[model samples]
Target chain A: MTTMTSNALCFGDEFPASGAPCFVQVDGDGLTITVESEGDDGAGEAVPFSALTVSAGGLDHDHLVVKWTRVQGERTLYLKSPDVIRAFRETVPNHLSLPFAQAAEQVQQVRHRRRLVWSLVSGAILAMVLGLWFGSDLFVELAVSWIPVEWEQKLGESAYRDFLSHQEVMKEGPAVTALGEMTHRLTEQIPNNPYRFEVTVVKSDVVNAFALPGGYVVVFTGLMKKAESGEEVAGVLSHELNHVLQRHGLERIVKSLGLLTVAAIVLGNQQGLVGMMNQLGVELLTLKFGREQETEADLTGLQLLQRAKIDPSGMIRFFERLSEKDQGRMEWLSTHPMSTARAERLKAELAALPKKSPEPFTFEWKQVQTSLGSQPVAAP
Target chain B: MKSEILYPGAFPMVRVDLAAGEHIKAESGAMVACSPTIDIESKMEGGFLGALSRKFLTGEKFFFQTLRASRGPGEVLLAPTVPGEIVILELDGVNEYMVQKDGFLAGADGILIESKMQSLSRGLLGGEGFFILKISGKGMLALNSFGAIHKIELKPDQEYIVDNSHLVAWSSTTSYSIEKATSGWVASFTSGEGFVCRFRGPGLVYIQSRNPGSFGAWIRQFIPVSE
Candidate 1:
C-alpha cells in the first residue's frame, strides 16, 4: 500500500514554545513521525496506536489532537487537515479509533439531551398556562360565593346611583309605575331572596335594560314602547332580576378586577374592597356577562315567570322579535347577543314546565307606551 | 512596577511599588492605602462604550482606579472587596485568560481587559453568565477569589470537571462545556450540584474552594427579616 503522509505539528516538552513541523505516516501497528529538515531526514519517533489518546482541540474544535507519553514528558500531535484525519481513522486499529467513536457519541448525546430539555421546559410552561386559565375560573366562582349580599347591595347601590346620574328617570309616570308593577311580580316569585328589589324606568330609546348586583334594575322607555303587553315588559324584568338573583353582575366585577381583588376580599381588606367598588361603579354599566351567564339568566328567568304565574311566551316572543331586527343601535341586543338558539332553548324549557293559566297585569300597555311622549307607537 | 501579595491566604492584599511614571490599574475601590507621591485617577478603560459594555454586560465596574507614581517611587496597597486569597498570573502576550466577574484585583499597564460574550449554552448553564472579562497582552495580573484559589494544570487531551460556581478563571486555550453534575438529571439536582463545567485541557484552570452563592444562602437564615 502507498504510504499516506500528512503534515503535522508535534509538541514535546523540549520544544515548549513552538511545536516542530513533521511528516506523519501510518506504519505497521503504529505511526512514525519524521521531523522535517533540509537535505537530511532526522531519526523519527515511532508511537504505537495503543499508547495514543485522541481528542478534538482548537478554538473551533475542528483539529484532531493525538496525545501520548514520552520519557521527557507528554507529547501532542495536532492535525488540522480533514484528509489526514480521514486517513488516520481509516488506517488506525479498532482500539485506537474507539476514542474518536466515543467522542462522536458524546456529541450526539449532548444534542439529544438539549432537545429533551427544551421540550420538557416548553411542556411545563404550557401546562402552567392551562392550569392558571381553568383554575382562575374556579377561583372566581369560589370567591363570588363567599361575598355577602350586604356588600353586594352596597356595591349595586353605588353603581345604580352612578348609572341614573346621567339618565332622565321617570319616577312617578305611567312608565315607572308599569316597571314597578313588573318588578313586584318578578320579586314576589323569587323565594328566600336576599335582595329588596329597586327598579327604575330610564327615558331612552335604546330598547335596553340591565340589572346590577343586589336587585338594582333599570328599564328604558323604548322597551315599554316596543312591548305590546305588560307580560312582555315583565319578561325583560324577569331576565334582569334573575341576573341579580344569580349574582352574575358581581361575578363579572370579580373576574374583571382579577384575583388580587378577590384575595383582598377573602383576606378581609374592607377598605381596599370599598375603593375597588367605587372605581368599578361606572364600569359596571358596560360590563358584558359571559355567554354561560346569559344562558343561565335566560332559563332561570323563564322559570321565575312561570312560578309567578305570568306568561313565559312573552319572554320568548320579545327575544325573537329583537333578534329579527337590524342589530345596530340596539344596545340590549348588542350586550345580550340575540341568537335564535336562545329563543328556541327558552321555548323548550317553557314546554317542559307543567301547564298553567298565567295571570294578567292591571296596567294598560298602550297608555304606558304613550306616557313617554316621544311618539304614538304601534303595538308589536 | 513590582508587586507582592501580603497576608497570602486570608484577607490578602497586593502591595505594589511603582517607580516614577509607572502605573497600575486596579478595580475601583480596591485601594486600601497609598503614598502621597502616588496620584490616583479613575479611568474609563477602553473609552466610554468599552467601559459601559464591561460594566453592564460583564457586571464589572465602569471605572478602573489608575495609581501612578508621578512624583517618585511610591507603594500602594490594594485589596479585594471579599476576604479571600489572591493569585498573580503572568501573561506572555500570546495566551489570553477568561476571568470571572469581580476576579480582577489589579494589573500592570500592559494588560488589556475587555468584555467577551460567551456562547448561549455557556452563558445560560455555565454559571459565568453571558459576558466574562477577557484579559490579554503581556503583564502581571492579580486575581482575587472568594476563597482559596486552587490551580489545576492538565496535560494534552486530559479532562477535569469543576463546579460552575467555584470557577475563578481559566486559560483561553482550555475548552469547556456545561453539563449535568450527575448522569441522571434528578440525581444531579438532588446532589446539590446541578451543573458542572467539564474542561478539556492543554491549559490551566483556577477554581475557588468556596462558593459565594451557597455561603450567602447559609448566612441568610441567621439574619432577621423586617416586615
Candidate 2:
C-alpha cells in the first residue's frame, strides 16, 4: 500500500488587505472552488460535507462556508473542496512553500536590471566612438582657430613659399605663352571678376588639366593632343576657367588645408602645412567631382557656351564622343569620365537654350595647337 | 586656351579656372561662356580627404540652370573636361567626316574608310582614343582594346565570339552571350581568362586593346569583389 503524503498550498505574498482576498485551486473530477474571506480570519475551519457543496465551499450561496478565528499570531488559509483537502493531506509536502515563488520573482528583477545597465554602457561606448570619428577634426579646427592670429598667417605664408619652390620643375614655353594669352582673353570676356586670371601650361604630357585658386589654369601637353580643334580645346579650358570663376578651386584648397590648420595649432610646426599641400595634390588627382558638381558644370558650362555663342551643342556632342571612346577605359572614366547620357542631357539643354550669336572674337587656336608640335608630345 | 566669339555674334568663350571666393559679375548683355571643366592636378599639392571632399563638393550641377543677362538666355556656360575628349560631327550624306576632335574643330575631312586594315592599325596601335566609325550605308561602330575585329555575317542561325569591349556597335537584331572563358582544367591553365562576351552571326564587331584601360577596369572592380 502506498503511504499518504501531504502537500501545502501557497498563496504567494500577502497584500495590504485592501479588498476581499480569494483562493482558487482545482479538485479532482471536473470540480473547482473559489473562496472569498476577510483578513480578520474569523472564518472557522472548513468541514467537508458533500461533493457538490464542498466543491463550492465559501462560494457565497448554496456552498460550504467555513470560518476560523485567529488571535494575533497565526496565519489562516481557506479551503473549500474535499478533494483539495485530501490531495493536500495525501501528496503535498509542508516544505512546498510560497517563499520559493517570491525568491524566483526577485531573480527575474535582478536580470532585468542587469540588461538595462549593459545596454546603457554599450550605448555610451558607441556614442564616444562616433564622436571621436566625425567630430575630432572639427574640434581640432575650432581649437586651432583660437590660437593667436599671427600663428595662422605664419603657417599659411610658409606653405605658400614652399608651394612655389616645389613647382620649380615646371617651365614656361609656347604652350604656357598660349595659355596666358587665353587667360587674358577669358578675363576680358568675363570682365567683372575681382581676382586676375592666370593660365599655366606644364611641359609634362600626363593628359591632365587642373584649375587653381588665385585664377590659375594648368594644362598638360598630353591633354592637348586629345583635342582636335579650338572648340574642343577651348571647351576644356573654359570648363576649368569656370571652376576658377566659380571659386571652386579655392574651396578645395581651403578644405584640404583644414586639417593642417588644426594641426598647426597643436604642434606649431611649419612642416604640417607642407604635408597638407602635398596630400592635397594626391587627393586632387583621384578626386571625381560629385554628380551635382558635374551636372552644374555641365549646366554652367553650357550657359557659358551659349552666352559665348560657341554652339553649346558642341559640349554635348563632345561628351558623347568621349563616352564612346572611353567605353573600354571605364576605370579612367570612373575617375574622370562622363557618360553619353550626360552629353545627351547637355545637348538637350543646349538645344533648349535660346541661341544667340556674339561679337566675333578670334581664337588663335592654330598657334596653341601648333605650339605642342615643337615640344615632344609625352604619354598621357 | 583660346578665345573666340563662335559664329557671327555668340558670347565670348573664355578658358580659365575660377578659384574659390571668386565671382564673375555678369554684364547686362554678355553671352554665356564655354570652357573646360576645372582640373586640380596642376594646381594643388596634395590629395587629402578634405581636399577630395571639397573638389567633389564644389562642382555645380542642375537639371536646367539658366544664366540671364537682362536679355533672356544670353549667358550659357559649357564646361567639359580633358584626358577626356568631346567631338560633335555633322553628317553630310554617305561620307563620314571628322568634325571636332576633343573640343576643337578638326579642319581636314579625312576619308571614311571601312577596311578592317585601317581598323586594325588604329584600334591596335592606339592612334586615336577609340574610333567612332559612323558607316554611311550601315551604322555606328565602337572599337575596343587590342583584339580581333570580328564580322559576323549570317542568313539566320550562326555563332561568333565577341568580347563586350570589342563590341563596337550592334544592330538591334543580334543575340549575345556572356560566358566563362573555359571549363575544367583548361580554365586553370589560361591566365586571366573568364567571362568572355559571345554573340551570334549577322553583326559587325570592333576590337581594340585587350585589357581595358584604368578607367574601364575600375568600374567592374567592385562587382567581382562583391560576388
DockQ leader:
1
lDDT of 2 at A267: 68
Q: What is the Å distance of residue A18 in model 2 from its true position?
A: 24
DockQ of 2: 0.00
Residue pairs with backbone overlap in model 1: none
Off by over 4 Å in 1: A1-73, A77-217, A220-275, A285-364, A370-380
Predicted structure 1: clash tally: 0
Taking the tens digit of each residue's C-alpha lDDT, what string does model 2 give over A245-291? 55443344335556554455336555665675555545544445556
Residue A371, model 1: Cα distance from true site in angstroms: 8.0
lDDT of 1 by residue, B60-146 (tens): 999999999999999999999998999998775545678998799999999999998676688799888878988977778999999
Interface RMSD of each: 6.2, 45.8
Residue A114 error, candidate 1, Å: 12
